[model samples]
Target: MQQSIMSTLPLLLLLLFSSLFPAPSHAWGIHGHLIVCQIAQGRLSDAAAAAVRGLLPSYAGGNLSSLCSWADGVKLRYPWSAPLHYIDTPDHLCSYTYDRDCKDEDSFRGRCVAGAINNYTSQLLTYDATSPSTQYNLTQALLFLAHFVGDIHQPLHVGFTSDKGGNTIDVHWYTRKTVLHHVWDDNIIKTAENDYYGEGVAEFVDALMQNITGEWSQRVPGWEECSKNQTTCPDTYASESIAAACDWAYKDVTEDSLLEDAYFGSRLPVVNLRLAQGGVRLAATLNRIFS
Candidate 1:
């Protein structure tokens, strides 16, 4: 009995130590939570929805200025972000079929399985217009739908075989240990926590959207980029070590040097471009579902 107790003591102490140190923040939680709140507010009206969407670019430090503005700005008559024409049939879900090694861009069969999930949710929202469903309005359902679509656009969010969507790549941000996904989702955001998310993240996202909206402008080309870049995109991003990805993703902006650069200076324009697409798409989804 004494010997057994002695062995268990060390295990108990180790467990206690771990419990004392909470895991660092998860980026998905913060952003996803914010997305959910936006969708819920959108239920009011188009003006309400726009007002809600406005709040997103400015969310910060527990402030509600953006939220108040969004509530005021939503308009029922405003144009929806251009629909991804590729979503024509509404049955195709996977946008990155090419990411999985499918050679044909037109093949409906090769889309990433997650894209199917996206399509399904999108269809669900579309149909909700005529008839309503209780299960659909649940916070998780909204958050999952909103957040997953966002994830699909994040090049690294759909990781590779070796890294398993960056879950396997381990690295340290400051003194704490973290995986690649967590680093991208949380560490990067937390690193820039001081910048008012509404002002900073919103400004960054807005600029990205404006720049790409002028260039790509339409959802079809945006989807086409996903199709064309799928196979190479994941590997292209995974090509860097975990640390490099973090550094490249944030670079001069997240740090204190006050240096101004596109949020994605060292990386391919595709990442920021897609991020803008995802944000606008997310906003559009909210608009359509609530309109």
Candidate 2:
């Protein structure tokens, strides 16, 4: 009887844990849509197969029906959010320290780091590649690559030192309980939904891609500079935080209340430009590898 009860404790704890944060419906199939769209744009021969590889079970089992189905009504219309899976744990978020070391004592942190690196590498490859044989894989990979690239750019993804990436900072978002990470992930972009979903999102991401060309070209050197310039890191991180604060405030107040607009508007051009540059570079990478 004692043994049985002890065994049941683990099961009970699992059940309780599961209930605390129910898996969101929108979470799974997002990566598939981003991948499919990019591949379709490239028109790769094996685009269909590659796009479906990491799709959610629902999408893979034919419940979703189409790749575009995944994007029908996602949060914030930030397509990049799909491929960049959310790290629910605070430990995971804070693991991305300046030194590339993860203090988290779990496999999730390792997986997250590897996933991020792989995503980055894939984009670099796709941007440089042009060969037909490798183009298909590169093209398909580019979509996933692009989406993931955007995810890393989100300051919250890197996280703060003490707050565990905003998870610990609990606050109310329009009278509803929310945290800093959620605000960054959904709120800031949500405020821009009207503008972001339409031509605005495309334009914003495009401009960013252009501005980051030189920095991205020498991504290694860029990070080295970033390390030396630690002060810039906090400031850059604060910019994102302030944008998030203004976004949460927007829902209640007039549009003018959203000060993030000025910053977002000013910064969007650079974002879009960098994305375009990354995409092109990603293609170039694939060409070189297979050529």
Candidate 3:
């Protein structure tokens, strides 16, 4: 009886843990979003900066990073939004087309991150200089933009549809068991926190914001195009993420593989690039909206 009871404990514990953390966590973890916001906040135009400060709720105290995780915070309560953080593509094709692939699991449709970004950006545009600070859904728009931009940059968030965006394919980060989606969402950012900065997340974000002093420090308002063509700007980001997901995030990963030195060595650079781009684009978007 004692042995049998002990044998059931691990399963019981696992069930309890699952209940506590029922959903796939936020993309890029807390640190990734914070770093993105802090970097963007540092680059804001003075008018854009002041406007952002005016729009935030009193609790956030004009600090954008403070509300970086708002979407994840409200996810459980608003189940309809669960699918808004990512888009899924069929296995190995590595492309995104809105006409076919933009719908989520819900038949209601158009709930994917790409769609949400476009919708929310339009919503933000509805607010103008004469609009009262709290006159519209400005806070929601800013919060959604801050979070979704980071989501679109995370490769696995736009990953394969067949394997449930790498949620089903299991792997290990060194010795611990984890799934591919999570490894990108949280592990890489957490590892970066512990290894590179060796400090608290806020401190790390501050350090990152301080270092954005190159050519793009004073980022302009409407320059999010990573491609030459002016159109397709939104889908272009989704497509880029899909390519990264197929080529890199899932590279060398398998059900039996242990992700370690070779995996981190090559892939961490991509993570940093996405983070930087997310930050720059987010800042530029806000500047366009407010300035």
Candidate 4:
């Protein structure tokens, strides 16, 4: 009886911990991460694709999208990484600077989403097929880089500190009581999938792919380019996010504001554009890293 009681203690502690600190809401949700990674995998160069396939475990079947949300799932095990998913800027400032705003709640510098991108990009850069051992886990690094790239593009991920990037703001998403951050992360994308794509994520991806090759074709080159030929340009992406947050996301939004068709219709385009950019940029970064 003593042994059996001891054996169950770990499980009981886990349950208590979960109840005390529930999993924080993930940025972009699972489908959003899937959409970004799927688009990215489709755009990888031959060399990048080969490297990605070699790094991925057998269960993944060489599909990076299959594990795009792996980082979010491991948050409990990697408690320190929670801060790496978003940057909280000064309320109403509507601007982001790495030095000033990139710290976590503990004020540790270079600990935000943009910094995570740079850190993981550097880790993946050390990948070498010739080396039998590496100091870093390139597989985890690749996964982190891919996910952070997607996170930085979500406007509210770079949102105001006072509101915890809209996570604290109580709002009704078309009669459903939810936070504003979730409205962007999952609700909007889910609604788009349901209403326009017949609830098919693949169909939604198809439409974005078409737009990328069609209406947004010319902008693709610019999106994929990092200034000064850097491997990744997350700072630029974060800057764009805060601007979008101010101009679109936080605009006309307040505590308990009901958001419906008018809000959805106008903001869906921004969400789509950001997702497209995240995919394009992830591919570009991987191509540079593997090249």
Candidate 5:
């Protein structure tokens, strides 16, 4: 009995320490959201640029990318915003129908990520810098749209209902005890930025922009599908993520899965496309709103 108590003491202490310290809560990881925001900033129209300049001076220097992670930073104070990060679908069905899914009990009249995107977007359309309340709403709305766009693109954010979007399924990247969601959220992007684009974040963003060739860089007009009365459009984006999550993110994944080069190599293109689409679509949304 003494030996048993002694054996468990270390684990008890470890649990206490871990609970006190706690790992950082990352949404789309910092650099992931930054990359998407940077791309959108690069693609913003002149009107959109002017609007961003006026609304976001509270950031480090009015840089649009500065506010990209604002929603994550505030998630603690506003617990309600947490569900804005992901949309859940039923297990193994491998498809998204927003009407059937996307609604959670905690949601405000069934507001999920897609619904949040649409709701906030309409607020941006009537942005008023003069009124303090309007200014505050505008800031929050912009932050939500920026973060949600990146979030929805992450395949796992539109993931299975069973695993809390892969958060419950344990896995590891090399030696780190993480889960499948973190692999999609941080590991892959971290690997790409650190290993492939070793020149640091700014350089990496520049390279990513320069690498955007073929149809990836092409601008699409009227690309804000969530504008006005339309709800199905954002669902389409969620559907794309759900499909990718089922077909790719869940492939061969298990609790003991060890992620490495092969995993990153196969999924890098998907990551890039998601980022590109997110950036372009974000620019499209801003263009329409601030036009």
Candidate 6:
């Protein structure tokens, strides 16, 4: 009996650790979030920049990018926030509607990523409220807004519900095994950094910044436009993501499919475009909020 109990100790410890730190389902990895926030901080209006600086904690050193992944980090502490990272659209629909699909598994409306974006945008809008009773934590609102904006741009974040945004669809990214969702979340970005950017995220960000001003300059104004002059337009971002999920992410792929150079080369442009749009729109939303 003593020998058996001792043998089970390692198994019990493994279970405890696994329960404490479950695998993450974040939309974009840390590098992706950092890239988006860095781009956004550089484009902030003078007033917006000052407001951001004031809202950020001193430990952040006024660099919004440094804490862009704060929302993902706090998921274990804030379990209720897990559902706000993505919208699980109906299988094969290739479309998104706030009224139709923006809810959690429990059918709570306005509980999806788009809804989170709207909620945070509204909270941050009260930055200058004359009333002193504003209870909203504007700092948290900013971090969540920044993170969800990056989340909403990831195509798989608005993917088919059957696969839980591709989390269930196993695939091979080259020789390594991973899921479709993780492919979008981290693998593609990691490959880009290693192969093209010398394994440096800052270099990847600089390249995207140049494209924002050079290759993608003409179309950026359209990306920043919000219907009816809304402060932020997450629905548009979500819709684009679903479309891209169908056209690029879920297209011609299946369980155990091997994704290699063909997949990477075709999808990298879409990834780049989405990351750029997330950054630009985040900046635009902040500029509107603080103006």
Each candidate's number of clashing pairs is: 13, 42, 0, 0, 0, 0
Stretches off by above 4 angstroms in model 1 are 1-116, 119-123, 126-131, 134-140, 174-176, 190-265, 268-271, 285-291
Report the C-alpha lDDT of model 2 over 1-291, residue by residue, as the tens digit.
574355445434433453454344322123323322343234222432333332222223321123332222332344443323332223323233322432233433333322543544544334331232233333334333434333443444444435544556665544456665554455445444456555344443343343444445455233223244221132232234324333332224322233345544644443333233323433333323223
Model 2 scores worst on lDDT over the 10 consecutive residues at 62-71
Model 4 per-residue lDDT tens digits across residues 1-291: 574355345534544564566566768988899999999999999999988987776456779998787777667978898999999999999898999999999899999999999999998888886663348767778888999999999999999998999999999999799999999999999999999999999999999999999999999999999889899998999999999999999999999999999999999999999999999999999999999
Model 1, C-alpha of 98: deviation from truth (Å) = 8.8
lDDT (C-alpha, whole model) for all candidates = 0.38, 0.37, 0.75, 0.89, 0.75, 0.89
Q: Which stretches of candidate 5 lie over 4 Å from their true place?
A: 1-26, 106-108, 129-136, 218-232
How does each model score on TM-score?
0.44, 0.39, 0.83, 0.92, 0.83, 0.91
Q: Which of the predicted structures, 2 or 5, would earn the higher lDDT when compared with the native?
A: 5
Ranking by TM-score: 4, 6, 5, 3, 1, 2
- Give model 4's TM-score versus the native structure: 0.92
- Name the lDDT of candidate 6: 0.89
Comparing candidate 2 with candidate 4, which one achieves the higher TM-score? 4
Off by more than 4 A, model 6 = 1-23, 129-133
lDDT (Cα, tens digit) per residue for candidate 1, span 1-291:
574355445434433453454333322334422432333332235643443333222223222222221211111121121111111111112123334432123444434325433444554453343343444422223334454444445444443434444556566555667665565555444444334345354454445545644766665344323335221122221222222333453333222222223332334344444455555545544544545
Candidate 3 residues lying further than 4 Å off, grouped into runs, are 1-23, 133-136, 202-212, 215-223, 226-232
Candidate 4 total steric clashes: 0
Error of 1 at 118 (Å): 3.5
Query: Model 6: per-residue lDDT, tens digit, 1-291?
Result: 574355445434434554567547567998889999999998999999888877766556778898787778667667889999999999998999999999999999999999999999999988963332247867778889999999999999999998999999999999999999999999999999999999999999999999999999999899889999899999999999999999999999999999999999999999999999999999999999999
Error of 2 at 57 (Å): 15
* Candidate 4 positional error at 154, Å: 0.6
TM-score, structure 5 vs. true: 0.83
